[model samples]
Target: MDIIRIEQLEIFAYHGCNEEEKRDGQKFYVDANLYTDVMTPGLSDDLEDTVNYAKACKFINKFLTENRFDLIEAVAEQTTRALLKEFPKITKVDFTINKPNAPIKLPFGNVAVSVSREWHKAYLSIGSNIGDKEGYLNQAVDMLYDDENCKVGAISKFIQTKPYGPVEQDDFLNGCVEIETLYSPQELLKAVNAIEAAANRTREIHWGPRTLDVDIVLYDDEIVADSNLFIPHREMHKREFVLEPLVQIAPYAINPISKKTAEQLLDELRGQSENVNSGCAGCQGCAMRK
Candidate 1:
């Protein structure tokens, strides 16, 4: 990844823990390094293809003057987030805010804070078995696209399947999504839940009928099991509904535990699962029902 460097832009702001530092204000030097695809701008010679350094500088200046903070770390963190929010093209950024005049008892050159952040690619599984099945599924896709931080990529055709557990309900429309997002796993989960809630999903029964159901299948090769969620979902392999749609977008995608591709898992599942396929194409009575 190429970098756009802004070395030591000087600014005088009132950001410090000391009374004098805030009252009289001090010279705070800021350095920002934006990370993204600079090759496009270099080849196309288009300003829009890259982040506008001049505008970024102005943004840093305006944000510092607008907000009041007590520490240089806070200033640096907020600045990084502001830059990312303002410029959609920036994938990652490293920024440092310098306080040259520290009121410490020792003579020092400067005290600064630096931090970095970036986006990650994630895959999600969505299913709905209740009212407006197709509607809930499509709406979830639309909502993911609406988010600025989320880049909704390839989506698979929805396939219908029987209910997974004891709950008796209508068939479900299930599929997978390839998403690029700037949110962490926890943050992304919140966003997906919001989308589900917008579809009027309720968690009344386990593996039950839901207006919309969304699960984070993979987050950049991470393995996690937390209080609210789990990655490489514990039960993905056993469900043909999840596997078929996943195979559509990513046939070679693997299960973190079994170390098998989605296609491989689907093949194994076809032999054991009760109802596998939803009847492919024109098959009058297909056995591969999910």
Candidate 2:
């Protein structure tokens, strides 16, 4: 990634722990490294092709002066998030705030705080079997798009599929969504859970049915396994509904654990299903058996 560097841009701000410091204010210097693709601008020689550093600088100055915080750490954190939001081309930010006149007894050259933040790519599997299945799925997509921390990307067309577990239920409309998110895995889980709750989903029976269901299928090729969540979705490879929709949007996305692409997994799953349906006596690993 190419970087646009902004070094030591001075601003007068009121951010400190002491009462006197907040009242009197202080001079703060901000340094930022904006990570983005500048090759388009380099080739096209157009200002619109890349992030406008001048405008970014103006925004930084205004935000620092306008916002009041007790810690320069907060300043760095908030500024980084703001920059990422304000400049869509900027995928990541490394920000620093220097407080030269910190109220310390010992003489120090400077006190500063730095933070680094970036967006993460995530895949979600969404489904609904209850009332207004398609409406519930659309609502979930709209909610994700409306979230400031998420930028919704390619979405697969919803497909109707039979329910997974033994508990008898109606057919489900399933789909997949790709998103660029600022939230970590845990936070992303919370966000999706909130969406499910808003759709009036209930956990009355395991794999029975629901108004909406959302699962974190994958996140930045990172593996996560815990009591509450599992990345690469524990059974994504075995489920045709999840893999079919996911392959539509992200056929090349690889399972971190198996290192197999979505397309490959889907093909293998279909082959297995064919074998089982054909009564292949040698096949011992059929999904139907389990």
User: lDDT for every model?
Assistant: 0.85, 0.94
- Mind giving the per-residue lDDT tens digits that candidate 2 earns over 1-290? 99999999999989998999889998999999999998999999999999999999999999998999998888998888888888999999999999998999997899999999999999999999999999999999999999999999999999999999999989999999999998989999999999999999999999989999999999998999888989979999999999999999999999999999999999999988887899775445654677
Off by over 4 Å in 2: 281-290
Q: Give per-residue CA lDDT, model 1, range 83-104, as digits (tens).
A: 8878988889999888778787
User: Global lDDT for candidate 1?
Assistant: 0.85
lDDT of 1 at 140: 94
| Whole-model lDDT, model 2 | 0.94
Clashing pairs in model 2? none
Clashing pairs in 1: 275-289, 276-289, 276-290, 277-288, 277-289, 277-290
